[model samples]
Target: MHVRNKSLTPLCGSSRVARLLVPSAACTLALSLSVWSSGAAAQAQGPNPPPLAMGLIVKLKESQTPSVVRLRPSVRPSDAAPSQRARLYAAANRKRVGFLIQKPTAFGAHVIHSGQFSSVDEAEAEAARLRQDPDVAWVLVNRLEQPLAGRVNTVAVPQSGGVYDDHFWLKDRTARPGVARFATAWGRIGANRSVAPVVTAVLDSGVLPNDDFSGRLLPGYDFVSEAQYARDGNGLDSDPTDLGDYLTSGEKQSNSAFSGSSCQVGNSSWHGTMVTSMLAPPAGSGFFGPGILAPLPGAVVLPVRIGGVCGAAISDVIEGMLWAAGIDYQGSPPANPNPARVINFSYGGSGTCRTGSATDTLYRQTVTALESKGALLVAAAGNGDGSVGVVGPIMPANCDGVVAVTALRKDGTKSSYANLIDGSLSAGYLGIAVAAGEFVSGSPGVTENLHLISDTGASTAVARYIRPDVDGTSFATPQVAGAAALALAVNPGLTVPALRQLLRDSATSYTNTYTTYAGSAPLCSSVNRANCRCDTGTCGVGVLDADKLVELALDLATNSPQPDFSAPAVAATSFVPQRGNGSLAGGGGGGGGGGSLEGVSLLGLLAALALGLRQRFKSGRP
Candidate 1:
């Protein structure tokens, strides 16, 4: 099921696309520069388009391409430019076909050409030949996979923000941890405004331009790989603008692409718009008062679109995350000048993440790589309450090194629909909680009314409306991300663990006095499933207190150095030797250097450390 905006109320009238004879220059430019392939436009608008593979994702053995040795006979492919590396490899292969970089990817993997095969047989043969090379680690065809997000079947009851202002959540006297006290923190950290904008990436559905994000949004990349799911009449280019994710009734029933996946017929959620707006809403929009990071002029949001009409794929999400953090690899997109210090995930799939699953392994490697760059990840703990039977937070969120965020109702109790982390099974990844409003019974406040782009019936006509009663863990995630940006503004050198601990330490304690549920709501766990109270073990350390979080950050920056609780790696294990035939020369199971040492004992850790240092010394990686 999708964690989405539950309701929508149209504010203004719709205009027909044909009625506008002279479209604005901006609109004309967007159309003129559209990157639709010859026939891709027709297919994108069709009921269903076959899943397409851009190429094969291949990982290279790191030792094979170490820093070039002077006056060496062996030619170093890594020394060449990324675009020219293919030709260099081809020369090394004695005239055989070689792979070209199709797109950049995370870990040691990169998306490479599948060759000019006349048929499926020819393609497989080429892949097999490439796999036999000593430099290649693994070769897998990039299949089209979908992320888990579907619409919730709920009727819309139109409500306006007239009763109370749209920014009610900004300061709710009735709620615990009511709208993070950003104002109090701003007073102390205002001097840090001159620093460069702390880039925070929002990896979700593509965003649309609006007044809320005037000068704050960076030109982000769209990672949706397929034309049909992209819904933009183009495969993957540079544009990250959200067209519309709305699906037609015919497509939902007739198209296997939409019918077979976790997709349902619904209006475009404008999810990205809602998320970014929360981070930097206009200063004095009479409706949406101000955002969490509005005071910090140096904080900007990067809108990296990982999902589209259908959901996103695991591969695309991983690629987007790495690209957002400013890691350069072989990719079509230009280098990210404004790499994000904090990345926010407002979407997730179901189920607990496994240790050795392909997706899980890839995500772990990506996270480790990002951590090396000093970036932090904040993700939504899926919206699977007792009703959905999901035991813990979903993948990526449950992945190590990510700060998973769960939701709390206005009154400071666990949200009725938020997925609770089973601490016993979570492996110490339980995350913080924030007040994402629940307008249902027993909750004290109204739902959020945020401005977002919505589809009008007429094609080419889109308008901004205030979506009422918007509630989900999807919305709760950005609060923590914006807070992280604020924290980074004060101290640019904070590590991932430091920011995580700071958020937890400054959080408000959970309140036991529920307005309506009283003593009925039990502590949420695998056994008690739904509508339960959250303890520190299951939900997080405490409710997010932006005011306290920033105060602590400023104090740490001015008074003393932040504590370092990290287990620093003693050696690099990824530099194993490569055989002459392009295979790993030693160390079985693909040169196991990047494996997680989370639960290893001190003795085991020391033994591994000694072995790793010996290997590093042998490989000459001082």
Candidate 2:
């Protein structure tokens, strides 16, 4: 389906877009387990593996030091006590700064340091050594990671008719006047049009080419490396068509990750499309007369699929994310031709975010890398019903360096299912709370409140608008992401972090109108709509105040047009323009506006001098 830049060369064989195919976070985990002996052994066995190639992390005991860590193969039990084994484990990881594994389940699993490698050789060398050890049972490279959102499945209705009726979120609420006053913002900021096009990457279930995306959806890549997950005939080759992910009861039983399906076992949610639409719908596809993007809204969505029928793999998500940002992936995958300035990850897993933890570290690295590329990662707080205190923190969302979002309901309060970062909550505020991720019509709560029309089923012809009446942090995330894109559209030079700060500064507070009955879903009434339930714990800044954010961005643009360096922005604007000496004003320099007999202005002088220096360097002249 209209893959962006397919006109270039086919990623694999050209015949595929001539056909279509489909398939589909950060956490640093320490995987560095090395010792001098193992390094020597691995080197002897073969040439050192490429450095920075991802590898596995092995856990060590409290008394263990990398030099002292050792292991006993699982095949035979060691006669030594548990304490002794701990020392052996410590001995195994010599010459490494591996983090301690917490509540480890197996020899190398659980609360791991996914990637704290000194070098590829060191990591593989350790793996090699561990394999040879009689005590060591396993050593897996920290290869990939999976998404933890939309995992729980439900028999959702794919609403085929108009339910949201018209573009609701895009309008200024007559009642809640501050509710995303799009009308005024659009006028002040050029009506979601006028601004330069911004590329946003959606890393989730692959998106189908639907009329709604028309000319905006870019040709995206599928990073699913597993044949089962890919659901296509093969593994990882870059045909990203969404194959509807519906599972049979028997198939669910066979799957071990979730040990039979709980929630993520239904027809493909077409989740990628939903997230993409939130960013900006195709020109004429919105409930009102045009899509959310409207008249000339020029936002391009790059769909990078990482989710499959069983949800998503963390590894695939990581690689896809890297690729989407125009960054190298696992050291391979072609660099993205169009690196996104905004990235929306509306899916995440459950876990307490420990800064030094493996997953957290990887995620942080990803954030740094993307931020350097001028991309913002807006993620979901997760749909988990689990307590943050009991299970720890929700990942990706809880991970530092993202605009984690929480959901709100139409009546105006936290959605029961959405995870929150509220100070009172066990885990605390994870992100900003925006309007209920989605609104639904039909029955009391059936059709989705937001009208999203996109491609559906394995077949491309089935274009339908499924108003998925679901609410969670995943849905809430896109609003913030879209806002970032809109803000960038206004201030092309705004830094990602500064844009985020602007969002925080402009967020609206929520009153908890939601109350729950025992054994029932939480419900919100207009009466309690002003019960404000946000704090530093649950809401990042507060609810998304779109109009206010745009106003702030507009103010920034007016006050200063130079690139923001304060968040001190670190974009790869390390970019340099080729040297040129185009004529400026006529040599006469006699115009009233340009009355200057001087040869050149200070800035112009610097430009000329820099170009001269470059020429000299290139010529190798003294």
Residue 210: error of model 2 in Å?
0.9
lDDT, residue 371, model 2: 60
State every prediction's TM-score relative to the real structure.
0.68, 0.61
Which residue segments of model 1 deviate by more than 4 Å?
1-104, 108-164, 172-174, 177-179, 187-196, 251-264, 385-389, 425-430, 441-461, 511-520, 561-622
- TM-score top scorer: 1
Show where candidate 2 strays beyond 4 Å. 1-164, 176-179, 191-193, 250-265, 286-292, 295-299, 386-393, 422-430, 437-443, 446-448, 454-461, 511-532, 564-622
Q: Candidate 2 lDDT, tens digit per residue, 1-622?
A: 1111100011110111111111111100000011111111111111111212123433332222211011111101112235434644554554343543322221123223332222334555656665454444334334322222221112223443333344455666543322355545566666443576677788876776655566777777887555554567555656677664444445546654323213222234466665666665654553413433443355478888776554454555666776787654212255566677788886554344453444455455566556645678887765432111112125676666777776555434554445556344323233676654332222322322343443334222265444333334555667777777777777766665567678778876543222221112222232222213444444456667777788788788778663432221122222121111221100111111212222323333344345435434433466
Query: For model 2, what is the error of residue 158's alpha carbon versus the real structure, in angstroms, after optimal superposition?
Result: 12
Best by lDDT: 1
